[model samples]
Target: MADRRSAGSRSIAIVGPYLSGKTTLLESLLSVTGATTRKGSIKEHNTIGDASAEARDRQMTVEVNSATVEYEGLRWNFLDCPGSIELAQETYNALIGVDAVVVVCEPVVDRVLNLSPLFNFLDEWEIPHLIFLNKMDRADVDFMQVLHALAAVSSRPLIPHQYPIGHGHKLKGFIDLVTEDAFQYHSGACADPIPFPEELQVEEKSARQEMLETLADFDDKLLEELLEDIPPPQDEILQDLKMELGADLIVPVFFGVAEEDYGVRPLMEALLREAPDPSATAERRGLNDADNQPIAQVLKTYYTPQGGKLSLVRVWQGQIEDGMTLNDVRVGGMYRLMGQQHQSVLRAGAGELVALARMDQVKTGDVLTAHAPAPDLPVARMIPQVYAKAIEADNRKDEVKLTSVLGKLLEEDPGLRWEQQGDTHEIVLWGQGDIHLQVALSRLQRKYNLPMTTHQPKIPYRESIRRTTSVHGRYKHQTGGHGQFGDVFLDIQPRERGAGFQFTQKIVGGVVPKQYIPGVEAGVRDYLARGPMGFPVVDIAVTLTNGSYHSVDSSEQAFKQAARIAMQEGMPRCKPVLLEPILNIKIAVPNDFTSKILRLVSGRRGQILGYDAKAAWSGWDEVVAQLPQAEMHDLIVELRSLTLGVGSFEWTYDHLQEVPERFTTQVLQAAWNTK
Candidate 1:
């Protein structure tokens, strides 16, 4: 066993695809380390992770959960991150602060591709990580086949550190490749040493040799020993493993059933022996240890029911005492978190993951320090929102409160975004997917006592004319002693597409007074707000050609009413057409699914521009297209389904295009029905 006492406090993240047993692995780790008296089951809704009501109701991790434990005299902080691809931003944010990561996944080969995005992220950041193939006892495939599947997705080379001793549910033990020792697992107890099975000698030898060869790739001495057929000393092998792992040169693979705690102890042992310590992680993050001034980065933020606000932070350098000031804000309290439980602590040292209470000014991804100013630490880039819903307060009186509450929600989860749509005049909430928005809405209701009604966001549609029309109008109201009299002549014409709206006065001879001319232009704009098609009009120009105004009755208000009458009669005769927003989109997916994506795009009435191999991403292609906004509501949902959840897209507003004549009636009917 390798000693981790000198490493000080360490933080690790449990991350994997949805339903991959990451939470279960976390429960096992806490149990084996004596942090908890017994393991809590996920089905029973008693697990330390996923303790939030939203998570328990859905039986999935909706946010990041933090817990601290003492294993062999070393404090270990574990962050159990949400596994849903939609909530991946939570995992990415937490991963940047951790010293190491344990990527928990199932042994199924087909589902292994779900790990590709995660693997790419980890490798790109050079964050040292290892794989724990969970549910081995239930896996029906060969262990080697599963290993090969996992290797296909990861960019880094994988070396098996342990070989399984049995297949499927009969899995009872594992042979340590480095030590060449076999041990049998006992329920809820430490593994006992067992004689190396002779039947597995050949397979174990191959796996062990393969592991050595990979390690040799980075070690000249190890290479020489392999070339000379001399067995390298065990200590030399362990040191090489630790060095390469810390540098992120290789990914060591291990397997076990986390639910039964079968391989949990060995996994923890490997972490102790091979995982990088905080100092190594800090160096990698470009922190100067000599500066000793307290600096920390917020990994996640929580708005607790009682505490008001809690910022989960990783202390990168120096110690943080309770009530210490950071970034001009005093920390109200400091605590170590175990799920939702907070254990008050007076102080926290470097490498410790602790929650600071009442850090309302701090947000997720913010770098805070007591000193003047330091280089800001890099935070995870927020993923683009793929789904959106127009939300409104059910009570109407809570409208202002809803906006305030949403700001706190966005601070807690950067994945969420909200905007007041300028075009549609609606409050829209955007998120990674429907489920993500559902959780946010649930938070609004449960935490803030604000109920909201949500629906698919309305697309911003505009209308324009197909022809020019000249019209005249006169407003003469004789309701008082001085009769209101105003006359105006206007010319309306469609400009080139995307030319937008323009209004100018072509009046001459002072027939229409300059004072009333402004009113005429304002009335033209007001009519354009809602065209004959029941949508905002665009790409048209209106000119005030000629008009007459009475000195007493023809005021600006009279001219405005006259101009409105002209437009109301002329616009319908000019032949109005509906225009829908088009988005320029780039969809990225594995090349294997390129053909399927093409079909999907065409089915959504999208025009494919072209496709090319995505830069820096092997075997992945980027498809460019222009898609109507009306067809984009559920596009991401279908895209992920077709590409095994690895596909993503970037989109920006292109130009408004005329709605095809064939579908114009349908669009108009839908618009009317909504009214």
Candidate 2:
């Protein structure tokens, strides 16, 4: 057994695809390490990770769960991150701060493809990670097949640290490649050492040779020893595994059934021996020489009903004491979380993940330091939103509270965004997919007690003229005392696209008074906001050719009415056209899905600009296209369905173009009906 007590403290993330038993593995780890007297089960809703009431109710993790455990006199902080792609922001943010990651997965070859996105992230950051092939008892496929399939998506070589002695639910033991020891698993206890099985000698020898060969790539001495038929010592093999794993040169593989607590102890021993120390990770991040002042970076922000606001942060250097000031704001409290519960601590040292209370000014990915200026840290960027909905308060009186509640939600999740559209006058909430927005909406009702109704967001459309026309307007009224009279002649013409609304006066004589001219322009601009197409009008020039006004009765109001009258009559005959918003989009996916994506875009009236390999992304292609905003509401749902959730896209407003004639009637009807 390796002595981790001398290794100091370390933080590791438990991450993988959804339903891969990551939480179960966390529980098994706690139990086997003696950190917990009893292991908790997800089915019982009593796991230490996924501790929030919302998580328990949904039986799914919605945010990052932090917990601390003491094993073999060494302290470990386990950040059990949500596995849902919709909630991956939590995982990405926390992964940057951890020393190493344990990627949990099932033993299904087909399901291994789901790990591509996460594997890409780990490779991009060059983070040291190990794979735990979880649920061994339930797997029915060949173990080597799973390894081969996983290697297709991973850039790093997969080095098997252990091989199973049996197959499927009958799995009984494992052969440790480095120690050359065979062990039989006993439920709820440590595995027992057994003699090497004679029936599996050939397989075990081959696997051990492969593991050694993979490690020998970085160790010329080991390679020379192997070529000379000289068996390396056990200590030397372990040292190579540690060095190669710490440098992220190879991904060591382990197999277990987390639900049964089998193979958990071996996994822990491997981590203690192979996982990198905090200093190694700091050097990898280029922060090895950072000043000794207390500096911390926030990994996730949480708003609990009991604690108010908690900023989950990782201390990169120095020590952070309670009541210390960071970002010029005082820390209200410091705590170590155990699931939903927290224990107050006086101070935390470097490489620890603790929650700082009432640091409301700090946000996710923000770096806070005491006395000294904060450092510029590289954090994960938020994924682009692919689904949106127009939201409104169910109770009209809660309208004022909606903004504040949504602000807090946004603070907790940078991926969740709310914007008040000026043109549509709708409060739009955007997220990764429909389920993501739905979860946010449910939180609004459950956490804040603010019920909201949501519908597909309306596309921002504009109206432009296809022809030109001239019309006259006259406002005359005979009342009790002073009579009101104003007249104007205006010419409306179509300008080039994107020209916007332009107003000028060509009055040769003093027909329209200069004082009234301002009012006429205001009315014309206001009327253009809602033209004959029942949408904002743009790219049209209106000229005040001639007009008349009365000195006493013709005020700004009268001239404004005259301009409104001219627009009401002339715009109807100008041949108005509806224009819908177009978005410039880049859809990234495996090259195999390029044709499928191209068809999806074309079917949505999207025009494909071109395609090329996505930079820095292997085996991936970027399909550039222009898609209508209206067609994008459910695009993510379908895109994920087609590409096994590995596909994603980023989009921006490109331009507005004429709505096709086939869809014009439907869009016009909806616009008029909404008004």
State which candidate has the highest lDDT. Answer: 1
- Residue by residue across 295-409, what tens digits does model 2's lDDT show? 8899999999989999999888788999989999999999998888899999988788999999989999999998756778799978877789899999999998888898999
What TM-score should be assigned to candidate 2? Answer: 0.98
**What ranges in model 2 sit over 4 Å off?**
1-3, 289-291
- What is the lDDT, from 0 to 100, of the residue 500 in candidate 2? 88
Native-to-model Cα distance after best TM-score fit, residue 404 in candidate 2, in Å: 1.5
lDDT of 1 by residue, 1-675 (tens): 245676678899999999999999999999998999989998999999999999998889999999999888689999999999999998999999998999999989899989988988998889999999998887485899999988888888998989998989789899999999999988788889999999999999999999999999999999999999999999999999999999999999988888888899988998888889888899899998896888899999999999999999999988998998999999999999999999999998889999999887889988989987856788887788889999999998998788789999898889999999887889999998988999999999999998999999998999999999999988889875878888999999999999999998887899998989988988888888898989999999999999898888888888888999999999999999999999999999999999999999999999999999998677789999999999999999999999998899989999999999999999899889988
List runs of model 1 lying over 4 Å from the truth.
1-3
Any idea what lDDT model 2 has?
Answer: 0.88
Candidate 2's clash total is 0
